[model samples]
Target chain A: MMAAEKDEQILAMIKSGGNPERGYRMLMDAYQLPLYRHIRRMVQSHEDADDVLQNTFLKVFRNIANFEERSSLYTWIFKIASNEAFTFIKKNNRHAAFFDKGENADELESRSVSTSQLNGEQIREMLHVAMEYLPVRQKQVFSLRYFEEMDYRQMSAVLETSEGALKASFHHAVKKIEDFIKSKNLY
Target chain B: MEDLRDELKNIGSRLDPAGKNESWDIPEGYFGEMQNMVLVQLHESKSNRPNVNLRNLRSGLYAVSGIAAMLILAFGIWFFAERSHSIDPAGIQELDQDQVYAYLEENIDEISLDMLMTDKQMESEILFDQPQSEEDWDVLLEDVDLHDLNNIF
Candidate 1:
């Protein structure tokens, strides 16, 4: 179905008195993975991602009654997901941890979570670890552009950043990840 | 995952964009379970809204304030106890000192052991329980105006 038709159906089911829970379930089904991936990348913990995603949906459900049609449903939902991740990261002190690390451990060892380590791991795993070194905003820009393949316009709507700034952040994120991986000898 | 070697080499050159890999750690079926957990949480918060909302807070405040106000008023009355308007000063002046001495000597043993009562207790007893009423002596002492001290007779 087209985006507008799907949104219409979802909204109708949710607004109907018959079974609104079913509509909520459908909404979850459609947006859960996209939101989860974004959250997991930002938090670097499966448990934290689960928390953030649940909060995102809870916020969505609580605010759905006031959803205006100014933005597409997809954009609105993504915006919520993005905001939740940022808030979760800040609340959990993930940003503080990254800043305190001073960015200098070539053989970073994290037994619980290989957040920025590349000790004999594959290039893919190293790539995952390297992305962890980015600032929260840059990491998000990179995740959306590289993995989610969101265009500049979609990213701008969700991140509420200008297209030029987002492109610059993404560029800086790519360079940082590449440098981190190579300098750590994770070739 | 696309190789970043090309991108690394091109960082100083053409600056080709790098690749992405999504092998993050997660529990099995986390997304499915997360949805159910969220729904359960929503249902729980909704059902508990009665106890969590502002209406309950307002009601609880009123009940607490009522009890506190009653206690403060009762304490204030007790703390500021004054001579009653009904006390007959002339009646007390009419008793002879010899008659009072004789009465005290005869009833000293049953006079509430006033020696053992604290000064405050003795004062309170003398202030409130000195009068005779139209009932059994003990009944008048224990009951009468004290029945629902809440009415503050």
Candidate 2:
């Protein structure tokens, strides 16, 4: 039931390469929700998140043999999910489309948060739109830290970034998000 | 790290932080559906792998076909050229002038009357067109080098 125990069991099953169907099912059961949430936050659309999540698991299954156990399985899984999210975005040029509306960042922020709902739901949607404006690494660091509550050390392992750099990136992201919130008067 | 967290806490205090429990929605039973879909995809991938030996066999067959086609084309060209330049040894045997004369005499009856008339006209022309005089003969002889006769032969 504990994450560590489950990770070890899944690792053993996958490493054995026997009863791979059971192993794969267990792997999916263990990681599916968490990985989906992570991917969903990054991609910001249910359909795209679904696709990225599936691809992340598919890549995991395909490349499970090459997993060297150098890092925790959690970190490794997040790393793969992150890479898949980034690749999907880049390949589809979603970043360009998100930014190429001929609207300034201030106007875009105002438009995104201009929903009928005036509660926390509106704020959350506004936050999501604001996230789209961050540079790639800053967004990633901020998301992992704020949403997932990941520590700098774990983030470093997953992102392969230095902890100090991740710390800097997170602060920068926070400042940007705060400035956007103030400018949009979404409060 | 604590400073970063503190700063984030301050920034998101007025706004709910982006969290997993945000109001995103998915179709009902999506994960259950995805499991089956992913398994099917994996199985299809496994099934779709090209057989190594089969691929190699196909390649070999293609290579053999290409070589055979080239050989057939080359042979056809050679056959065409050989046929165009073909000579019959029996038909090309050397003949003496007497033999030619005898053969012509044998075939004289086969010649048409018109052909005989044409031949007579040619002979008359030649006879009438003889050298006019010794001077003319000398001029013609001067134009002809007997040594060059060997070159013609």
Candidates' lDDT values, in order?
Answer: 0.72, 0.76
The complex in candidate 2 yields a DockQ of 0.20
lDDT of 2 by residue, A36-153 (tens): 8777766676888889888888888888889998988888999999889889877876652323321233554565666645566656667766777776667778778877788889
How many residue pairs collide in each prediction?
A: 0, 0
True lDDT of residue A37, candidate 2? 78
- Standalone chain B TM-score for every prediction: 0.34, 0.34
**Candidate 1 C-alpha error for residue A168, in Å:** 1.2
Q: What are the per-residue Cα lDDT tens digits for candidate 1 across B9-92?
A: 555422233424466656788777888988899889889876567888899999999999999999888655543323643355
Best by lDDT: 2
How close to the true structure is residue B113 of candidate 2, measured as C-alpha lDDT? Answer: 47
Location of the lowest summed lDDT over 10 successive residues in candidate 2 chain A: A96-105
Fraction of native Cα-Cα interface contacts (under 8 Å, chains A and B) also present in model 1: 0.41
lDDT of 1 at A114: 46
